[model samples]
Target: MKKLAVIAATGLSAGPAFAATGPFFSLRNTDFIVLVSFLAFVGVLLYFKVPSRIGALLDSRAAGIRRDLDEAKRLREEAQEIYASYERRQREVAGQADQIVANAKREAEAQAAKAKADLKSSIERRLKAAEDQIASAEADAVRAVRDRAVQAAIAAASSLLAQQVGAGQRSAGIDEAIDDVARRLN
Candidate 1:
């Protein structure tokens, strides 16, 4: 590479000198030699099939690029499909969650209603029991009062009869009661 640069520099520096002294169509010119050298270089490259090799290299590179582009496009489509599937799944999950919430709410409402009914029934049963107890207590009190009154009336009648009867009448009454009892036993 250094040698090529040195040669190119020498040629460029000598170019003006050659142009000033040379006929326009001279075969002994430095430009002619440079032209011949360039032609010879091209001829050597062709003889070695370098042009065809370069063309093949470029074609392979293009094929690789095209394959990469196709792979990228396919990957992009797959990613989009996966994203769409995830979105669909999310929506389904959201809908199921809504349904679950609705079901939970309905169950809560039913439970609340059942609790209210149970509480009401319990209260009603307690109230009825209390009323029955009150009524029974009232009947017992009335019976006790009637029993006490009957006992008092019987005592009063016995005391008045005892006071009104004389000793002789009381003895005759006892004799009569004894006769009546003897007759019943026989």
Candidate 2:
């Protein structure tokens, strides 16, 4: 590597000297002056270590970019976790609402069954009362018919006794008939 560098330097110096129109080392030679100025500028850059400083700056910038990317990834994962928690809560609430609706329906069905039973009982009681009233009315009608038959029999007996018996015997016969009728009625 040292040999190659030396060869390259010799070539650079010789090539400018050959190309110059006058003495290569003299101030009148523009090529020599240009070569000196370029060498000085290169020497100043090397003395300050500008290339190493630029490399360090670029490496620090790359590290900062990597940290930002890591932070963004962590924040995205946290947001996803929060979204999942909300979804779970929403599902739980929906399940609770469904349960409430089912319970309400059961309650309403129970109420309807109770109402039907009550109505049936009420109708049965009314039917029993109507039957009792009809039985009472039938008993009253039978009693009235018996009373009318007894009265008509008494009137027929009185008319037959008057036609067949004389006055004194008729009174005695009527008294006997009344006593018999009272006994039979009792």
Candidate 3:
């Protein structure tokens, strides 16, 4: 109603003579037709509230975009945190692996040293046993030689005694032995 009042005021201000002189709907009256069409378009736009609806649509779209951007930012931060956690875990696992390797190396070295010591002890025992066997063999050889020497000395002495005592001497010694026995009896 206000727009109608404004249009009416405009027409009135143009003067009654201007309306009377022009053909209202003629092709020759371009300016008047153009003015009417422009006013109708403006009226339709106002009746539908097209500009405010467009403003509301744009505001909602902007809010949705803002929310989406915030969500993207939050997801990015979460991803970064997860990545950092994984990196830290990886470093810890690497350290543990290194320590495990070091421990294994130490254990291996200790085992090797123990083996070396055992080998040395075994060699020493074997060497000592061999030496004892050699010494026992040497003692046995010495005893055998001494026994042979004693047998040889006894055989030589028996030969010497047999040669020194003749049959006549043996008889005289036997007669002396008999007289000595008779005296003992008396």
Error of 3 at 101 (Å): 2.6
Q: Would you give me the overall lDDT of model 2? A: 0.90
Q: Pick the candidate with the highest TM-score.
A: 1
lDDT rank, highest first?
Answer: 2, 1, 3
Clashing residue pairs, backbone N/CA/C < 3 A, model 3: none
Compared with the true structure, model 3 gives a TM-score of: 0.50
* lDDT of model 3 at position 171: 57
What C-alpha lDDT do the candidate models reach, one value each? 0.84, 0.90, 0.82
TM-scores of all predicted structures: 0.57, 0.51, 0.50
Q: Write the per-residue lDDT of candidate 3 for residues 1-186, one digit (tens) a residue.
A: 999999998988797436555676665676677778999999999899998999999999999999999999999999999999999999999999999999999999999999999999999999999999999999999889976775675556445545777866765655665566456544
Off by over 4 Å in 1: 1-58, 155-161, 166-186
- Judged by TM-score relative to the true structure, which candidate is superior, 2 or 3? 2
lDDT of 1 by residue, 1-186 (tens): 999999999998787646556663567776666777899999999999999999999999999999999999999999999999999999999999999999999999999999999999999999999999999999999989977876675556556556778877866665665566456544
Give the C-alpha miss distance for residue 30 in model 1, angstroms. Answer: 14
**Candidate whose lDDT is highest:** 2
Candidate 2 residues 1-186, lDDT tens each?
Answer: 999999998898788567778788888898778889999998888899877788889889889899989999999999999999999999999999999999999999999999999999999999999999999999999889988888888888999998999898999999998789878987
Model 3, residue 154: displacement in angstroms? 10
lDDT of 1 at 157: 50
